[model samples]
Target: MHNNEILCRLLAAATLALGAAGAHAQGAAGSWFGGIGVTHIAPDVSSGNLSPPSAPGTQIDVDSDTQPTIFIGRMITDNWSVEVPIGLGFKQKIQGAGAIAGVGQIATVRTLPITVFAQYRFFEPTQRIRPYVMLGLTYTYNHDEQGSATLNAVNPINPPGGTQIDVENRFSLTPGLGVTAMINERWFVDAQYAKSFLKTKTTLNTGQTIEAKIDPNVFRLAVGMRF
Candidate 1:
């Protein structure tokens, strides 16, 4: 009798738990959601030559940056959504590579990546957890490029006060994966990872140019509410 009583209690608890999970799901379809997140941007660089007037193999490397981000999303269907991420610019460290390897940073460049994503979420609407795949387009605007003392000292092309670089703005395709877990009827936690296939040319005011492939990996974590 005692064994049967315990079995009945366990089943009751499980039923209640499933009921709560179902209540949390409420399906975000046709709803608007917004969240605040923190993002990390790490560059995976394929450095290239700094052209003539520099070393035969004068190349450069880039470093990572992190910032707070805000995102707004709309659920177009039970399993699809669109998201836009907004944030302040990220500052990147431009350092020497290849022939100038081991040399420290030579410049600082600030960039703002504007991206729009179309995501397809998986799983039933009644489930509290969903995993998603996203495809996005991004345009990164590079500006405020300032050269370091190292650049002026080492480059034969350096003239007058100093030599600064200008990195052209470019567009990239971003593909990503993410998951969201509902905590209750109104709140959830989300985590995502994406990669941008980006490349650009940097021109020095002194008439030197270098090409680099800065394929960056982006990671984000956030808590959000659905309305």
Candidate 2:
């Protein structure tokens, strides 16, 4: 009799747990969500040899930056949603190495990544916690390319004091994974990680071109409300 009573109690607890989970799901379909957060972008940089191998051992280095980010999403179904990530501009510094090991910062480039993601969430929408995966395309726009006087001293192609580099815009594929946890019926917290496959070429006025693989890894944390 005791064993049967314990079994009944376990079943009752499970039923209550499931009921609570159902109460939270409310499904976000046809609803809009918005959030704000901070993002950190780390680039796995691999740069090509400087033009003509002027400095045979020369390579480039780029530093990571953190900026504010905004998230806007629309739920199409119980398990799917579309998201747009709006990121503030990231500043990158280019430095010289190898033969010019001590040249320090040679240039600065500002970039903005515009991307849209299609996400598939796991578990029922009413669950308090859900994990998701995403795939998307990112468009990187590079601008404000500036060269330091140190770089100009090395190459005088334009009869000027410094050399200017042009970075072309490119598109890349991005894949990501994340988790969302509900704090209440109207609010939630999110954490995500994503990576981009990107390769771009930088051309100097000196008629030299260098290829760089700026595969960036992105991390974000946010708090949002559902409507």
**lDDT, candidates in the order shown:** 0.85, 0.79
Per-residue alpha-carbon lDDT of model 2 for 1-227, expressed as tens digits? 23235334433433443343324553467887878877778888888877763657666777788898999999999889999998768999888866777788878899999999999999988788788899989999999999888777655354454689899999999998877776668777677778899998988878877888989888777777788
Put down candidate 1 lDDT per residue, 19-72, tens digits, no spaces.
445446835689888888788888889988988989889999998888999999
Clashes of 1: 0
- Which regions of candidate 1 are displaced past 4 Å? 1-23
Q: What are the TM-scores, per candidate, against the unseen true structure?
A: 0.89, 0.85
As a whole number from 0 to 100, the lDDT of residue 3 in candidate 2 is: 26
Quality of model 1 by C-alpha lDDT: 0.85
Clashing pairs in 2: 25-126
- Evaluated at residue 6, the lDDT of candidate 1 is 33
Per-residue error for 63 in candidate 2, Å, reads 0.4
Among all windows of 10 consecutive residues in model 2, the one with the lowest summed lDDT is 1-10
lDDT of 2 at 39: 79
